[model samples]
Target: MSHAPVFDAVIHAPGRLQICAILSSVDDAEFAMIRDAIKVSDSVLSKHLKQLEEAGYVKLTKQAENGRQRTWIALTPAGRKTFAAHVAELQRLAALTAPEPMGQGFAG
Candidate 1:
């Protein structure tokens, strides 16, 4: 029997989903970069990042850069797997509901 699609509630939120997408494309991203990309305030991004971090789907590191502290974020191996599965499920659903091509089922 086919298995059900994997939909992780933790990563399902719009902001969190965007975060995962961004992290999946690169080795790591600065906290500010993700915030800007998601167009959220610092506190809002921090809240979402915290959730992902707690769920073991993201890793955050803080270091000094040019004498200033900066935070970098990246998805863990498990995060990548989970995100991929979630996306695959979404694609599958879309395909299942997609409309058929025109002029294929009717003949003049």
Candidate 2:
């Protein structure tokens, strides 16, 4: 059986949603991973990531390893919940726009 989602926002922005979706499926990922997945320039991704981070939907951490600093990102508990809810909302919206069953199309 299929279940609907319960997200609130539409999250239609390409890079932003992709970021959230990719991050949702991982425990944590590096900046490059996210940047590559979204296929955006470093500055572009950084701007979008900053927005998510400021919204409390993502967490960023910096650590030094072998004299180099690495940045990692992970969804917060709240971020996970918010992203899940937003995806659900999108599902419900899509359901509304889908064609009706045969012989019952175009409901007013």
What are the clash counts of all predictions, listed in order?
0, 5
Candidate 2 lDDT over 14-78, as tens digits, reads 78789889989998899988898788888998888888888888899999989998889998887
lDDT of 1 by residue, 1-108 (tens): 134468889999999999999999999999999999999999999999999999999999999989999999999998988888888888778888958788777665
Worst 10 residues of 1 by lDDT: 1-10
lDDT of 1 at 6: 88
**Clash-forming residue pairs, model 2:** 5-88, 6-88, 7-85, 7-86, 7-89
Error of 1 at 18 (Å): 0.3
RMSD of each: 5.2, 5.4
Best by lDDT: 1
